[model samples]
Target: MPSTNRRCPTVAAPPQPTDPTSRKLLGRLSLPERRFVADALRAETVGGVLLLVAAVAALIWANTPPLAESYQAVRDFHIGPAALGLDLSIQHWAADGLLAIFFFVAGIELKRELVAGDLRDPKAAALPVIAALCGMVAPAGVYALVNVFGSGSMDGWAVPTATDIAFALAVLAVIGTSLPSALRAFLLTLAVVDDLFAIVVIAVFFTSRIDFLAFGGAVAGLVLFWFLLRRGVRGWYVYVPLALVIWGLMYNSGVHATIAGVAMGLMLRCTRGEGEERSPGERIEHLVRPVSAGLAVPLFALFAAGVSLSDESIGQVFTRPETLGVVLGLVVGKTVGIFGGTWLAARFTKAELNDDLAWPDVFAVASLAGIGFTVSLLIGELAFADDPVLTDEVKAAVLIGSLIAAVGACVLLKLRDRKYRALTEAEERDEDLDGIPDIYEEHTPEYHLRMARIHEEKAAEHRRRAEAAAGSRIEGDRPA
Candidate 1:
């Protein structure tokens, strides 16, 4: 079907910009965003460990004799610029101020996932995405059913609809399970999506009133921040003051100030053009994530998790509707939601689970999803701010629910871990004394294809060397 007399049309290539300043700015922006993600992941793992210790210490301090008074006093202490309506208690600062930093880091990660990570591909992200949605819906449904039918308030529905990624991953690391990498990826994507939903719920459902002028001012500040980024302004002095103004404006606007962090993060530029070496989002994440994971999150945990058990007995705590509902919603509802959702997706849709994972592996991971500590605690604080009794009850429930889920995951994942270890050992064994593993050789096509590719690479290298030698000889002959 080739045309004999066809003249190829002349197509012009897009012109490249030649401006030195523009090129320099562009060239300065190229660190791999993947590295930033890896760094953030590590930071979260460490943060999880620190959060655990801080929570335990807070509990001890809140319950022990004289220390309990000191703990209460510290949390109740208030000192800030009262003129600006910022004279908030320590607990308020932790929830509103420090948590914003944590949310900002989360926002950056969400942007990365949406733009270039697994979420960039809908088909590939289907299982986790579907699972996350179902996970949230199912938990909220359970909470609503429990609270609505009982004497509990319906306002706390969103409390159990969160997944603590750091705590869950910390459990995994401690357990030392041999899960497939895909499972970790699925868990992470699901957690990020879960956080995104929680943020939406906080912004929309939780807000009571809005000050339009203040909200508009916050929006304007964000727009100006975006403008500075687009114009290649990288100074912290320029962005920090603007970010604080936005946060304060948002706070005054009656929207949760933490939402400001998510908004600003979403507005950040993530794409890299021809001349840029690194995207603004990646750079900002690198600069800010350490602060979030190391200080902000742990400090929030310290202030938020200090629930005293002196007033109410453990039995009495569990009897409360809010407590029972949160425990059931997290432990039972989360397991059912995530596992059932993923199973249904695989059954109904063309999307399939990773072949490397088994049904039990997914179920174990689903149990891990129930470890809703951080955001669950945050929501509990918000939900029961007026009722100290309910707040204590809810906090106790979150801790208990997280513990049960962690234990279940450890047991299930440990069983799978042994199986994987056995398989790996079998794969490493070469009883026949061949160069390759016996298992690899048993899979003849795969083994042959791998070897053939290696052979082809060697052959190509030889050909290139031969061509270079021939050219070198011809050049020498001509010169002589």
Candidate 2:
């Protein structure tokens, strides 16, 4: 039997360092990471567009005179079985239940990055990790500073700490068409770390009390989940019901139910077995990502983003310190923290920005990171759950801040895009003069031979069609 193992073309060797000690930040990706980033960007781009539409619809629904009351009524309507303590408002269901799927997908991504992707290397992971941490810290600090002397409570500090991967990717996909793939990879890595931190903050800082028995049950279920995956359990029927049970237990335990999703996701195997095309984690992520992006996240955004944009509400967003803090944290703090942290890492460590990118590119991407819509809204709601007025104010701030960031990133990235576009055109012109197709220029001899074989096959098909037509005409005169 022949061996089926093959090296993927996308996974090329990293460029050798000119200096032994110096490392490149946002370097070329391995095959799996490249494929993952491509797929994720595609999904998140569509998801981000839908999320924007849903948010806009929500705002219009909430602020319109005739539909405002109806919107509130629908969001507040109760559903779910009460016997198992699952009853919750429609809005809560979107938040606690649908968002779990989103986090579950996130967990799978995190696991893959940690195990098989760039995050596996300590040196490679350092830049994004440091940047993500600083990104979170700076926003929280800004929020705290604003709320300390102001009338608003400081509970909403974590609200601005999140970077919405979907929205950020969407913005990048739009404005950075000619930008380096390294920028997307950097943003994806930074967002993954940012998500992990956000989950931890939600679990630790937000939970008021824990029901020990329920918490224990949730842990036990997680163990069973890991055990089943280890044993090569394959059926969704078995895992789906079990996952629900775990989610319910986690919710009842006063910890965030989304944590259950993340736990299960982290436990799934990410490394492929011998002769396998993809790992179990990758398979599951592929199946669930569409559901999470298309349905779960959009639904969550629809329910969460409905804030009144009345003059009074708009006034409160600017006047209230906590709300104003959220605005500044997302716009100014995210920009400064990410760019500053990256600069610090490059300056102090052996790491340097990739040759394909520059300080301005990093700055633009950092600005794009400030579009903290989905998770920021979730944290805002959790922070100000008791204060509806404050929650609305925070939601408004998130929207306004994200909008500002989006616009700023658009302007910056557009300029970068034009520059890169001109560079690409110049390179293409040179390639054309060399008599080699640009696509085949960097391809290996093996790849060129394969493509040659494909072309020969097409030529053979054309000859066969011609022969068949000639034969048909000869027969037509004799038999017709």
Candidate 3:
């Protein structure tokens, strides 16, 4: 205890971390970083919900007269240098740039799924991926077929192919547990694949002719980043600088700058817990949650969902090919295609139908999948931004489609819920112990008698063995 008297090594003081939430507010942080993490999660949830509300409000505001003009003026406000300056153009920056973060979050989610969750098992993942592929390809084809002959509107063919995760989740929450767990898992998986497809579409089809010099610069930055990664550079430092250069260069290179969102997520070497620690998936999820929910998604919603509705616009929206096509494709097409595709995949392929989900329940789940609001809005903006009229019409279509899809899912789920309730009660009351399973049936009198006879025979054999052992002991004693 008196090490001070000896020339022993001096003990070092504990390191102090800056920006410690608990230290400032709640005193010493609890082990496992409980004090900060829980607050962050809660804050993210509140922020996400608030952002959704804000987006909806912006939509309302954008539809108003003088307010809409003011909003547009503010959106057009420039940031950055004079000649090198960038104007948000419209309410598009918040949606495009901020929503990039949302997409980055989506990328994180995809990574987590690949490492674990439903994507962990390849056999299980096959059906959802197939269903998603069909759902995407079919809708796009339908849109393309309707708009063939090199029509100017052909750019929006991918509009309806999206599945909005938030809108879908909202529908499912109302629907409750009448739907099978497997069906929900499938729906989630499919949406992720749809996101991947959307990213490709943006990168390949949407981008204009590339500026090779700027592209080359961007490539150089990425290569430099690769070396930095090898050198153990922190993500915040590397990605912050990396993102500015990439997005900026991509913007000049005739590529939609938002592609940088997904690219950044892909580059980060996802870190996990150390020896006997939690998974990297959990950590990445933690990091992604706030940025995506609190900031990126809300900002996107505000920007993308802004549409000024008037009598003229309403009349035009009904006739706009871009408008009608997206509405029909998402609302009508998604419901039928998802349900039908999944059913066929289960029957024809190695996948099984969700055993607990009746046909009615599957129908409900399919309806929920039709809520393509967010991604639909995003793609529509990218697809037809130069044509404001089409963009306005698309905004209306997505709103309508999301509403109809949500309503249909709610109604179908109600009916399915009643059916499951009746079936469950019937099974519970049945005398055959939970619907006549052999495990329960095997408890019958005849089965017990058969078992009892076998047990008696075995007891008799044990007694005979004991007698034989006693004889052996007696024989040995006599000989001795």
What is the TM-score (0 to 1) of candidate 3?
Answer: 0.72
RMSD after CA superposition, every candidate: 13.9, 8.7, 19.1
Per-residue lDDT of 272 in model 2? 93
Model 2, span 324-379: residue lDDT tens: 99999999999999998999999889576766567888899899999999899999
Using lDDT as the measure, what is the rank order of every candidate, best first?
Answer: 2, 1, 3
- Could you tell which candidate, 1 or 3, scores higher by TM-score? 1
Ranking by TM-score: 2, 1, 3
lDDT winner among the candidates?
A: 2
**Per-residue error at 73 for model 3, in Å?**
1.8
Model 1: residue 221 alpha-carbon error in angstroms: 0.7
Segments in model 2 whose C-alpha atoms lie over 4 Å from true places: 1-22, 173-178, 422-480
Per-residue lDDT of 149 in model 2:
73
Clashes of 2: 0
Residue 469, candidate 2: alpha-carbon lDDT? 97
Candidate 3 Cα outliers beyond 4 Å, as residue runs: 1-48, 82-85, 145-152, 173-180, 270-276, 279-281, 418-480
Across residues 4-57, which tens digit of lDDT does each residue of candidate 3 receive?
A: 233432331221222332212111222233222333334443653555586678
